[model samples]
Target chain A: MSCLETIQSYSLRSIGIGERLLPRSDFTLCEQVVLIGSGMIWNVYFGLMALTTGFFLATAIALGKGSANPWLRKPAEWFIFLFRGSPLFIQFFFAYFLFLNLKGAYPFFDPFTAAWLGALIVLFLNTGAYSAQIFYGALQSIPKGEVEAADAYGLSGWSRFRRIVWPTMLRLAWPAYTNEAIFLFHATTLVYFSGFPAWQQRGDALYYASYFADKTFNPFVPYPILAGYFILLTLVIIGLFGLVNRRLNRHLPANARSKMKLRLNLIR
Target chain B: MFSYCSDPDTLERLWWLSCYLTTGVHFSFYLSFLKVIGILAVTAPVALAFGFAGAMSARSQILPVSWLGKAYIAIVRGVPDIAFFLFFVIALDQGFEWLRHQALCPDWTDPIRQGNDFLVCPQAKLPLGTAPQAVHQAYAFALAVMTFALVFGAFVANVIFGAMRAVPKAQLETAEAYGMSPRQTFWRILVPQMWVYALPGLSNLWQVLIKATPLLFLLGIEDVVYWARELGGTKTARFTAYPHGDWRMWYFLALLVFYLFMTWGSEKVLSRIMARLTRGQATTGGEAQRKGAPA
Candidate 1:
């Protein structure tokens, strides 16, 4: 097939759209590139969904962890420890098994077995737990002066937190949170590779890359293409988070503003 | 196994479980936990060596060598590390075979890349085609170790490079004032001090390394995850002495607990080490120690 024909056939293949069958043999370079790039839709989808939704849970968790009451604190602490302490790969296996058992008991949970819903839940919780830890640290490190100053202005309770505490915690947490975001996106690659089966061969970028690698018996081509897509995604995340970092630190003078640094590569 | 395990069907509930847990496959499952530890024990130092070299080269005055080191560090930055794990295993295996093929079979003119097959001559095969299964396993294990070292070395290099830069410039200047050579300043003054700053990152990397051990299954190794799945799946009465329904959930739960224990233990030990390292240093940790001490 010509490159256009190949793109037309396999462009949306990752979501089980255009193509029902993946290329079997004599796979062309165009086919590999298009199919792998097509698979990135799932990666982007998982990352964005988990991140946006997980943000609220993370905030609540951070607050709970910082709470003085044992009732609030213990569960939050254990939640963080439970998810953060174990490997995510194992979490995926254990979760899939749990969901499968749940489905067995109640047919209502049938949708939980699919990668789109099931794997997404795991990613959501995992990121929530990790980002909670980051945010909890940020909450602790929020300068005492900021809170005392807010108190002097009669800003109290929810209003005080809304105006003063939350922004500072976010500002302090943004850099590490950026690293977490990138890691989350990278982790979307694990969904298919784990216990969650891709329905009808609809998997993520790594899934397609490995597929091509298996077919061609050539690792050099497809994996690099996967890596390239991921690099681009990483850059996009950094750029987007940089914008937020700037906004979060906008109130501070430029000279005193803390810049976001992509300090660690393998955080998770 | 027990004397009564010979007739699993007649065994009582607890006894059946005990026998099931002590079966030969379960023994191998137990052994795979050691394999994870073995990988960590070996990979840690090897990766440190690789990272030290990478950091030194990046910090090198020479342009090309510095770029090479920078590239090595940068390569792992943007991509998911699992990609590297998946890529490196096959890539390294083929690379070795291709090099050996060129060296060992000079007269062979047929293209190695014939459609989907990587057809290296038999002489080029790692551990040789005639080698025992044990040799092949060893070779695969070695490749896994190398792959882990290469990817993790880059992360370690980034840590060490930052730690090296973090060493206060005044200390190096004092070393120069003492008539120490540049090499002496690096070895005697810089390397010694870099560890305190590097410790936190290294400890974090250690946790990451621990979590990453489960990926061994992806490398086709019979690690804990592999055995957990194999042994946990439904075992039919016709096929085996002890048959059970799908018990994968329990197996994975056990694996999860093992990892949690491993990470929790590491955290405790790492904090102790961090405290010891910080006791005499000028960092905040040291200052706290100093103030808290009996004066």
Candidate 2:
């Protein structure tokens, strides 16, 4: 098939849209690129949806963790510790099995056995716990001077937080938050491999890559294609976050500002 | 295990439970835990070695060597490691066999890629077709270990590289002023001092590495997850000595608790080591320790 024809047939192959059957024999470069790129839709979906939802929940959890009230702080602390301490792999398994039992008890909950809801839930909670810890650390590290300035301006309650504390918290946390986001994207690949079944052969990038690899017995072509796509995706993320970081630091003098670069040192 | 387990049918709840726990499958389950530990023990040092080399190479004065190291670290960071694990195992296996094929059967040229089959000469089969089952298992395990090391080593290199950079440039300059050679400066001032800076990242990496051991199951090594699924699946009374309902939930719960305990214990030990390392250093923890001591 021509590259255009190949693209038309395999572009949405991951969600079972274009092609009924994956290319089985005579694997071509066009097929590898198109199919793997198609599978990336799920990766982007999982990462974006989970990150969007997890962001708000993480903020709340971070606030709770930093709260003076033990009722709030203790549970938040344990939640962060539990999720952050364990591997995402185990969390996926444990969540899957727990959901399995739950489904057995309540037949209505069987939807949790599949990737969409079940894996998303695990990714959501797991990323929330991780990001919450990052935000908590950022919240603590917010400059005393900033809060003091707010107090001097007669700011209190929500006004004080909105005008002063919140911005600084986000600014301080932005770098770490960026790291958390990258790691979450990487972690999304683990969803299918865990206990959650991929319904209708609908799987993510890695899933489809494995499928192609298994089918063709050629790992060299497909895996690197996925890797290249991920690198590009990661660069896009870095670029987007870099813009936000710049905006956050915009008011500061140029000499005082630090550029946000991809520091692979931090792993979730 | 118990002497009171005389009559099999009359053996009620406790005795039956004891026998069931001591069954061959349970032994395999326990051995799987050791496998997890064994992977960690083997992978940790090997990964560290790879990381050290990677870090050193990245810091190399030569542009190409540094670029190669930097690429290794960056490439793994973006992509999900599970993808690499899934991809590399088969790729490495094929790569090995293909190399063997080229070497052992140079003249015999039926295309290696015939339709979908990766056909190799009989002699080029890794472990050979006639090799024992244990050999195949060992080969798979070795592949899993190498994949783990390759992926995790990149992360470690990133950490170690940052830590190496974090070691104050002044320390190296001081060593230089004291008449130390370039190699001596690196050995005496840089490498030794970098660990203290590196410990936090390395400790975090260590925990991540521990958590990542379960991916061995995905790599087709029969680790704990495999055992859990195997032992926890539903079984009819006719199929086994001790038949049970689907108990995967309980099995996974056990795994969860085991992991939680392992991580909790490691955190405790790491904190103690952190405390020890922080003593007499220039950081906040060191300052705190110095202040807390009696004058």
DockQ of each: 0.78, 0.60
Docking class of 1: medium
Q: Write the per-residue lDDT of candidate 2 for residues B1-295, one digit (tens) a residue.
A: 4565444456789888898888777999999999999999999999999999999999999999999999999877777778788887998899999999999999986999887789999999998999999999999999999998998899889999999999877888899999999999999889877887888988888888888888888888899999999999898888886778888878887887787888899889998988888888777878999999998
Q: By summed lDDT, which 10 consecutive residues of candidate 2 chain A come out lowest?
A: A259-268
Clashing pairs in 1: none
C-alpha lDDT of residue A178 in model 2: 90
Q: Taking the tens digit of each residue's C-alpha lDDT, what string does model 2 give over A1-268?
A: 8999999998988788887877777778898888878878988999999999999999999999999999999999999888887778878888888888888899988888778888899899988999999889989998898899889989999999888888888888898889888888888888888888877777888887888788888887788888898888888888888899999999999987865756653334
Off by over 4 Å in 1: none
Q: Candidate 1 residues B36-76, lDDT tens each? A: 99999999999999999999999999999999999999988
TM-score of 1: 0.98
